[model samples]
Target chain A: MDLHQLWTIVSTPDNVPIVLLLFVVPFYAWYGLRQAFANDRLIAQLEGNPEMAKTHHRKIQPFKAGWTREVHVWPYLLRIEFLAAIIVTVILMVWSITLNAPLEEPSNPTLTMNPSKAPWYFLGLQEMLVYFDPWIAGVVMPSLIIVGLMVIPYIDANPLGNGYYTYKQRKFSILTFIFGFIVLWVSMIVIGTLIRGPGWMWFWPGTTWDHNRLIFEVNRDLPDLFGIAGRAGKIIFGAVVVGAYFLAAAVLIHKLITKTAFNRKIYARMSVLQYVTMQVFLIIMLSLPVKILARQLFRIKYVWVTPWFNI
Target chain B: MPETNGNDGKPAPPAAPAAGNGNGAGNGGKVAAVVAGAKAVKTRAVEEMKGAIKAPEKTDLWKSVLRVKHDETPRSRALGVLSNVFLHLHPAKVNRDAVAYNYTWGMGGMTFYVYITLVFTGTLLMFYYHPSKVVAFRDILYLDSDVPFGKLLRNMHRWGAHLMVIMVELHMFRVFLTGSYKKPREFNWVVGVLLLVLTLLLSFTGYLLPDDQLGFWAVTVGTNMARATPLLGHGGPFGPQMGMTPFNDVRFGLLGGSIVDSNALLRAYIWHCVAIPIIASAFMVVHFWRVRKDGGISGPAPVVLESEIKEPRKI
Candidate 1:
């Protein structure tokens, strides 16, 4: 029950659980090395039938494989990943017992716990929700992230190399998702400390974000989208923009007799891919700018608010 | 396309001049045909490779599933499973695929490998880890420094738990940027998301096992989050609102467990140590099987380096 007893038990060398893992890890490592070496030899022998060696088909041709060559993985990656994981584990274990986070109590519920937080690992998840609505942070964003992860193999089109891609291949998407996340959270934390005037993001007439009500707003706001005037305005404006697009074309066609070097048939065919790309880009850009413009352009900018980080 | 006839210069087997001749390019359109012909052969070759490598499905009565056959020694049995189903988890099977930059090893293998370690070490810890605060913390300490293999077991469990989270996330990231979920596999993506949530829950619940101050308060915070989830917690519909699921209500009914104490400990223990593992593992098998179904081992299609590819000779 005392700290000394705890230390003694933990420090003792004979502990079954800890010792077993130690042996098992090296055992696995040895097994890995042996397998790697044997595979090297096996591959050399199988070089006469390169196809058979390349694929994992169980069928073996017992021909006299007289011709031979050497091929093996250089700087084996599996070994590295395994080693990294092991190193991380050893570090975490050492840290767990060695580093105590200023322990407060023996877990008495009667006494209020101060600054209670989840384990360090789950903190990432909790921290993530700060940028998103509750439904999104708590549910949808994590869900989308996982779903997006699962489908990566099917989605990416870079051919030639299969499993050899690195962390940087799709850095834009990753950085966007992560930065969007951190910004969402850091914005709240900073705003929580500083911004406080009226509405969650607004100082009475001006609109922005308030840190405290972020979770509540996100979790609560989206569902009420169409039911409220604010949400209806978004829908209405979105509809109008789309409608205006088609109407503008109709007017342009009526007002001007447009001609091109190509015939009408070629013009329509040539323009399709370009049109789609432009439309997609336009839709994404239109969202916030339209919102700001619709606000009657009367709002003053807060010196600290980055437009993207605005809310 | 054909060699000149001894009597007259003409293509032989005109119906299919290239079909049975060397230098069949003399035939009409033969250059285009020959180039296209090589591509056709390659496509078939890939299909052939696929046919050869396809793991026999369980439905095949003739070919039994690869299993840890009982007759083998414990080590062989272990190796056998390790080579096949568990092969991806460990680092033993590196080949050309290992360094193929596009063939990067994702966290799937690491996740499962750590999982294997956890199972190996967890089963051992169950022999020593008590679920109660009265003895749980002490028992863990005893395992750490007292038991002959205690340190290894504890580290394995501890490290395995920690690594599983990291690897799963890496696995998620690998899957994501690769755009693997684009087509014919969206539902599996959903399943994977569920698996992610399950993994987080597993980690959260498992953290409560030690009963130390850190573990204790972690559960308090986590359970508090659960309570805030609109249904079960002390402040929820059941408390102020009176909402509780069958899994919790019937289970914890006898004990008026408002806080993360003994009753909460048992609930978390069942989830952490028992229920989650069984479910997560079953789902893992499904995950593996589905991968096989969706097309085993997804990544970019193989691109043999031009330096490595050889030009076949004309027969």
Candidate 2:
């Protein structure tokens, strides 16, 4: 194991945020989930004792008789805000003083940066380029992600867990979000930043980045794997395979959505349009991980390939 | 003469008599009269000054500026937030539990704070920076080696940007996890998503200002993706059939040319320094206003039990 190699990647000024992210994301995730589980416990308690539920102050936060429900923003909320701002300023000042921003040589278009990367945030999209065509990965996926996020409130018909964190209350929506954000978005960014090295090749953490390293693995398309040779036959085979995958995913998701009585109630609340939109987004989202698995495990390059585009 | 002055309704009887006796005694008496008058005036001035210092808020100037009393009373505290231009974004009061760091995580407020710092450092960086390729790199080098705190300035701007992006993502995550985007908050959430896009664009644009290899290559990789924007990009599917080309495509519009060149630098500079900030600020205004209009922070609200699930409202 090349400890120096790991340090080099981790300590690079630009990579620092991703390194920070590795810690920050998990910490916050645990922090949020802790509250969620706590609330879940409280929710279970309240459910069992309907008499107490009617009288109990529903929040896990401590409360007492004759206490004010609200407090002045001036000292209560504004003080915290002021303190937070001061803390942030100190952190930024310290960060700025210690670490200089990365500056490479002057622009020379003739000489290209090996494994040139988009900004760290866009690195997730850049990583997608490996599994899909540029149009789909770069353009379509990003547009869909933004649109899907915007439509979430309109689509989510579950009225429980509206103002508080509770894993049991919002199991489906919470899990779906965690999968999308932490798994797909953040994890991909981490992979793009740390694992993908020179020549955009995967290098395990602590492994030396060998610029000359090559993997002589054959990657095949789905149609080719199925022994389809003719142009028309290949196109038809790919279409059928992609269509089958979607249909299967839809069935599985539907089953999960209606599995519990609570889930069914939530599912029933969704209008037809909301249901369809949610399914389309979920299927598309699921395809990302499925495609990643296909490429990594089976060396499958494209599941569906056409004259103009490939997925 | 002092008694005669007293008859004229003068309250300073002691000072008047002393002055009158001094005047009768000639020039030395006149000096004594002046000294006595000065002593009385000083005592009265000190009393008035002490009263003013003790209750400055009662002064007309203070009242005009603050437009309200600022005592420890709850009414004054409420007015403290409601009366101010900046603090007015917030309501006079908030849910007691909402003020705790656990519920909100303070990410939204922190993100805004970081953005303010970015704008500050960015404005300073612009004073030393020129968008042209010829001097851009040299200017950065000059900033590092010569200009006072210029290196610090650039570093803060750069890191603060990355921090802002991180904070925005976290804020969104917290909002989602807490289910804070339900019902009336749905539109504000949409506004927030737009702001997120604008934040990314702002940072991406700023990446190229240094004209360094890191930025050049990163931007090259970025805009190259634009070239594959299906219908509009020249290299995208059906782009050729629809008359898209390298010279007249989405990528070309973004870069102001076929490649990342002088024009690209200028465009990035303009967008980074001017356009996107304005757009993001406009969205933020609506986002914050809606947060207030939609029933304040979405709570540490009383948890709803599963059995209490209301029937779906029929359209």
Candidate 3:
């Protein structure tokens, strides 16, 4: 984006965080992953090789001995935390002195600003309002995220990487979390902040919001695209599509993520019902990004819209 | 001893030992006398200086407060943390790996620090600020223009708050990446996530205190989103079917009325200045305590047990 656009985004209190998260998430993920991969290459290579793993483990055993020691928190952990606090205080002092917080005219109900926006952190949810109805965008997704976060410890079964960093052991979790936070969350914020203009119309970053600009977006769902007319026909067709999607995803995950022996062991460990529930959860979570993409790229909204609600 | 005269015509004390004494014995005696005389002169000088500059009496208050001693044994170090008021939040001992600068990156600590700053500055700002729409904006103007360094105080509080939100998010990110949230620390992780939510709530409530267009509109947008919340919201997708109304909805409860007005301002003021902070503070205490209870930040698996098992094999 050009400097004008950057300044416009930065000046807005809400958009500032979106810009910051967009930059920070990738840098941090890169840093964490880089450190993990660099140190855990041997661990990665030894995965799934039972015999070679034992030999490699023995080889590295001596070097790993001195990695950690118990030390007094008074001068170690507490001191560092205290120092960090002081540094932040100093930074805040400098920042506050340099930049005064924005305060516009008092609230006037008669006048509405163009692109009235939520705070930057919630911009992702605001952007989701484009693709999904308010209930799904504002209510369901947030509740799911919060509950999902709380339940992660119970759901994840791999027990190896508890007390240390290990990319090979926790690749699935790390990658999945990063994808959700960076791609789905932060990218949406960026889109909402920079691309969205007056009346929530899509605008390029360099362009200014123009009241006279005429924009039209026609969103066609599967039923409309396929010329399906009756409500019964649409309901049946929608159910089939949604069902087929989950079924295909479940089969693919089972076949692709595990070998025959591993698949059988997983199935034995978890009952059919539990396995199906887990697969369905994954399908729903993965579908969020796919739906967003459909809305953005193909102007497809409301894959299934009923009288009660739209999805 | 024999007496001798100096160039200034003053007689010196003693020039030489008696001729009757043995050479070695006499030399030793001369040396001893000289040494005694020198010591007396030094003592007199010290006494004179002591009189001129009185030495202050020592107190144990600082030493006791610091919980430190010259003899720093392992037990003393542990006691230092346990007994010290500030240090007691942390465990007596921590894994060295946990404190590694690159590992935790000190984000959690920084968040705590910023919150404290905000509390201090926010409390100060309250003295000059009134929550009424008319005075709220004027109060800010007064702080910036009339009150000396009022602008600085306001700026610090405002910026510290924004910084705190970012810090809390980063801290959670670090916790996730290191997998410190797993196992025994899972409860602490939940507490942390709750703290994150509270941080955002505090930020949101604080936004409306300025009563400016930016603050007002931001809150409007935020509470509008709340109105779309299912079941509890008047304008929610199922609000109509659920028999929800503007007077009884979640958004109304939050804003204290249908629209952003005096009630909304007062509600935000209470939430921002009092309610959310107290809740956040309680959660922060639990979060820190749980860290200690969970045996401190996660680090490398203890090698002692593994070494014990390997010791027998070597033999």
Candidate 4:
């Protein structure tokens, strides 16, 4: 879309939600990346010079007894906690008084709300239903995420960053999780909560969620978009694409990123079984944005479809 | 014993001699004596003020109510924590690093505080609320309009719930960024994640209690998501094919029927007020206890240079 179209979309009341969803990620990513880079540079400088490193360490270290007078909960932690609670309580009271919690008409199961939504936290999962089959999006994928998060500590062998927040010590894991959390989880939530309107259609922020404004577009698989005629051709093409992605990721991670001996040791320890599973999962996750872009830009959907599932 | 300063009750040096020639020296000494006498009186008053404000060490009215001591021994400190309900969750001593605002963002503490606020406000709301479908909405309306500070109570609970979720998520994010979930902390991290899920569940179930359009539809759509489970959900791919009826599906189990009805309301009520709270509280206890047992919240490893590694005293 041209700048004029973009500006019109943003200017329209109906497109307010769209504008918010579009803007949040790029802004946050830009900010987060700059901060991370600056931190990395500072840490590198400190580590390169021993005297400077000692000073930096001392600087970051919180006040010793003489400096800050740390105390027990009787006077310290409890006081801070209670003060925070009181402040929060006061703010909550003002908010509650000024803006009432929404209470709509009593539910009627017969008349489904035009654009039903889950709570904000689950909006990301709900939005995924647009790109994947329900079995994958709603059930298996969510289950995997919870399980994956719980298992991260066990699988990640890097031990240098257990106590600190240095990105350089744990770059891959930090970058990967950040991408998943922000781009996949948070961005999708913005879309589901704000942009989606009636019939699960996209609506801009200022626009009313009208059922009549639905845009019904045909979404086709990648093979279909490319005019691959037969089922066999599509399957072969899909397999080749999947294989190529995994191969490329494996080679890149191993060759380009795993330069240090510690990194190579960790990579070697991730036997083929572990490496392939993790790589495939990562690629599938990374492909979600690609699939979303394809659907939005080209109106292509179901890049891969089978009797049991579609992706 | 350290000499006490008459002016501040702190240790002070002995009074210096009045400096003067013989003629004025006697007057200067007299003036210094008067000033010292005034300082002594002020110090006595200050000591009394400090005593009055000091936390009670032993309450004869209820001995069990106060257990702390001004001069704590190892045994008394442990006993002080063990005897009190609130103090038991915390370790007697905390590392300075653990309490640093930037290290943990104080998010975990804020979450606990918010949770307590939710419980307090939620209980007050429960006193005014009735869980029936017909009266649920009316009860809320009455609470808002008719009851005294009822709106304030509901508002605090509502906003506090939202804040709790935000705090919990931020806490988890902080933990992730700091790599605080590694090593011996792995299980505590899992517990933390479970607590997060429980918190969301608590918020979700409570959402339906408001009985308005937002809660009703949100719950309806939220529960409907459960029906997409592959073989278990009645509306899922193989569910209908396998002859899975609506009554037997996961959604049905959640709502206690094929649709969101009275049973769903009661279930949400029970889950919100009793079941989830109990489970969450148990997990929270474990989470805190483990934090103490696991050597408190993680901090930066002590800096030791490569050359200093071999120097025993350098560390």
Candidate 5:
């Protein structure tokens, strides 16, 4: 594929992290090279003669910039701005040359692409939106997760492992995070692609939910009919679902191996193991699960009912 | 103090006069012991110096400062500059194993670099970026269409930002995969988690500034999604029925009305351009600060600094 098509795919939903990866490889290479050839010339000078070295900035040759001493300083972030300038200049030239890439048929407000994916980076969420309504899929889950993410530093009061923690020291939370991240992401992709359009529908129909549709139809309709009980059930169900998965793995193992009476510990341990294992399975299943899911969703050309959100 | 027989050419001690008092030789022994002790301390320090340079990020700032004279290389300047508050604060060395992840692979370091690149290009973009979405896209268009390096800087920052988000997510994935979010580091992990949220918020808010059709819908869908949660008895599914809470009207509150109007744009602009950056920066400071305070970024395996772990001297 030529650069234009490549850029579009990079900018849009392929669920591949090539764009970020591409940027990073060069960055670290530069980092390592700078570390090897580059001396902390400024730092060294500063120390060699702190008072007299106020003259270190002048040490840089006027155009010694043939290839080095690159770094950026702003927003309080110190990066290889000087080197970055060169790379960016080159990339920009290339991008500008390819900027003429034809825009896909103008996005018609009325006619939506069958599976109009979100900007590739956001396909994670677009992938999520499919499983949820505009509210849950699009907003609440992301908001909560993001908000929860914000609270992590505050809630994590431990001061032990800054750089690294031992195996035994970091068991529960690590496993939980991995399990939760995978389950949430993968499940969302599933719902977005697989569950989003058993029938194309929306979460709310003017403030009222049509419960009948959720069972035979897509999950978007489920939100419209969200009764207090159902919402509560979902919250509890999530816990149960997690707990049950753990339960399944263990009890199954116990049943197969040693016939022992089940207890809370057994159940909890089994459930935890089960969830973690499932997460691994899930992770392996799809490096870009959203893409696979999205393509699948788009493949279905016919729908019995039109979705309210309508692409 | 015993005087040897004059059989050999050995000098006789003053044993005849002060043989009973062993103070003279004792003083000499004490002096020798002191010299050995001092030598030991110096040796230990040199070893510590070597270890510090090898992994500068783990070394204390002042110690690293004291040790700089030893690092005679010119390239270390960049690595040295990394620790500069105003420059790249990368440690003199990094532990690769620390950044590896089992889940989504090694996205942590990549994301950090993404942030670095974003910060780099962002400064350039800020030179000409207007906070007004009304004119934000126009300004960007002008940068691309007219300004010599405007499009370059804009594209760099834009792509860099996107790369940052992806990297951050991947970082989180790596952290998860490797189970790095364990107990002791949980606190830092939590802070990192906040940083990630800030990253996402920063991105979402930024999308609105472009004011393109795509940008508008992205915000629309994002805000509407907020109404889905079971929070504060608002519009979330469980809340009271029709038009219950004022905030329940997701479309109205999120967009400052029923549509993605100018107000929404302004809010997004302020958030993306000003508010979010400030908040993220604050957290980043705390995050890095904690890295020093907390176990100082775990080094691979338990390799003790030879200087600090010197063997006892011969008796």
Candidate 6:
């Protein structure tokens, strides 16, 4: 193991945030789920006891009979805000003092950064370029992500978890979000930032980023593997494959959505428009992982290839 | 009563000692009267000054500046938030549990605080920076070595930006997990998503300001993606057929040139420093306002039981 190589990557100032992210994301996920499960237990209790349900405050937060339901913002909420601001300031000051921001030599067009990477936040999209074309990875995926996020509230017809954290009530939505955010978005960023190295090649942590490393693996398109020679025939074959994947994914998602009675109730409430929009976004989201697996397992470059575009 | 006092045309002093010399006595009496008048005035001034010190808040200047009496009373406490322009964004009171750190994680507020820090540090950095390719790299070097606290300023701005992005993502994650985006909050979530995009764009634009190889190549890789933006980019699918070229595509508009160069630096500077901030501020106003309007925060609210689930309203 090249401990020096691993240390060099981790010590890079720009990589610090990703290192922080690696810990922060999982800690928060666990923290949130802990609360979720607590609330779920409470929900189960309240569900079992109709007598307590009628009189209960319904919140897990302690509430005595005489306690005020609200508190003054002056010392209560504002103080927390003030404390948070001070804490953040201290953190920023210490960070700025300790680590100098990275600055390289004067920009020269003639000399390119071996593994030119975008900002850490956009690293996920950068990683997607390996699996899909730039048009899809860079342009279409980002736009779709923003739109999909915006459409979430409108599409989520489940009303049980409206104002609270509860796993039982929001299992489907929560799981879907975790898959999209933690599994796909954040993991891709982690890969792009830490794993992808010189020449945009995968270099596992502790492995030296060899500048001249080469792998003889050949990538082939699905059409080529199927022995389709004619251009029109390849295009037709690719279109069918992509369409079939979407169709199959949609069916699978439908089965998952209606697996339980409560889920079916929520699903039944969604309008046809909401349902379709949700399915389109879900299928598209699932496509990323499928494409990633395909490339990793089979070395497939593109499933669909045409003169105009390839997917 | 005396013959001399009548001749002088003066009133008698009740307790003044009579002087034998005529001109000397008259002058001494006049001086005594003046001294008495001064002592009385001094005593009155002392009393007034003591009163003022006792209740400075009751003074006109304090009342005018504060516009409210700040006392320990709950009314005054509520007014403390409602009356101040800066704190008025918050309600007078909040749900008791909302004050707890566990529920919201305070990420939203922290993110805003970091953004404010960035703005402050950015404005300071701008004083020492020029957006020309010729001087940009040199300015950074100068900032590092020459300008007082300049390296720290740049470091804070850079790190604060990264922090803001992380906080924004975390805030969104919290909101989603809590199902805070449901019902009336849907639109605010949309606004928030836009703010997220703006935050990323803001950070990306600032990356090019240093004009060093790190920033230059990072931006080149970033904008290179734009070159593959569907029909708008020159190299994108169907872009060539649409008459797009290196000189007349979306990327050209973004960088003000075909490549990352002097024009790109200037463009990034303008967008980073001027345009995007104004736009993001506008969205933030809407986002915060909607938060209050859409029912404060989505809870640590009492969990809604599945049995209590109401029928969904038909759209």
State each model's CA lDDT, in order.
0.47, 0.91, 0.72, 0.71, 0.48, 0.90
lDDT of 2 by residue, A82-114 (tens): 999999999999999999999999999999998
Residues A1-311, model 5: lDDT tens digits: 24543344345422334444445544543432242222234334445565644433322223243533333222112233344445545654465454431123322335434444344445457765433445445555465566555444334322222223222223334444544554555444333432232133433212222335554433332222333235445455445544554456555534432333222222333334444444433332232333344335543211111221211
TM-score of 1: 0.47
* The 10-residue segment with the lowest total lDDT in model 5 chain A: A301-310
Residue-wise C-alpha lDDT for candidate 5, range B177-268, written one tens digit per residue: 33345444667887888888789778777766666666665565566555554443245555445444644465556667655667787777
Error of 3 at B72 (Å): 3.1
Error of 4 at A49 (Å): 3.2
Q: Which stretches of candidate 4 lie over 4 Å from their true place?
A: A1-46, A50-59, A62-73, A207-211, A226-262, A265-277, B1-64, B71-83, B303-315
**What is the DockQ score, from 0 to 1, of model 4?**
0.30
Instruction: Estimate, for each residue in B117-165, the C-alpha lDDT of model 1 and write its tens digit.
Output: 7777778888897777677777777776799867766655665575576
Per-model clash counts, in order, read 64, 0, 1, 13, 38, 0
**Each model's TM-score, in the order given?**
0.47, 0.95, 0.82, 0.78, 0.51, 0.95
Residue B19, model 5, lDDT: 29
lDDT (10s digit) by residue, model 6, range A1-311:
99999999898999999999999999888988888998999889988999999999988789999999888999998888898999999999999999999999999999999888999999999999999999999999999999999999899999878777778988899999999999999999999999999989999999999999998779999999999989999999999999999999999999999999999998989899999999999999999989999998999999998999999
> Which residue ranges in model 1 land beyond 4 Å of their true spot?
A1-105, A128-311, B1-95, B98-102, B149-152, B183-188, B230-256, B300-315
Candidate 4 chain B: worst-modelled 10 consecutive residues by lDDT: B306-315
Q: What lDDT does candidate 4 reach at residue A293?
A: 80
lDDT of 1 by residue, A1-311 (tens): 34553344334322222333335433433443343334334433455566755763211212234522111221255456567568655755674455332222355666543334455445434543334323323433444445544444333322222322322223333343344323332333333322222222333212332334432322222213334345445455445545675555444432321233212222233234434443333232232233333332533221112212122
Query: What's the CA error at residue B16 for candidate 2, in Å?
Result: 5.9
TM-score attained by chain A of model 1: 0.33
lDDT of 4 by residue, A236-298 (tens): 777776677667766765563478765665565555665666665666676677667877899
Cα lDDT over the full model 3: 0.72
Cα lDDT of model 2 by residue, B1-315, tens digit = 333433343344455546555566778777776776766565555555555687888878888999988889999999888989999999998999999998888999999999999999989988999999899999999998899999999999999999999999999999998899997799999999999999999999999889999999999999999999898999998888789999999999999999999999999999999999999999989999999999989998899998888887786
Model 6 share of native interface contacts:
0.91
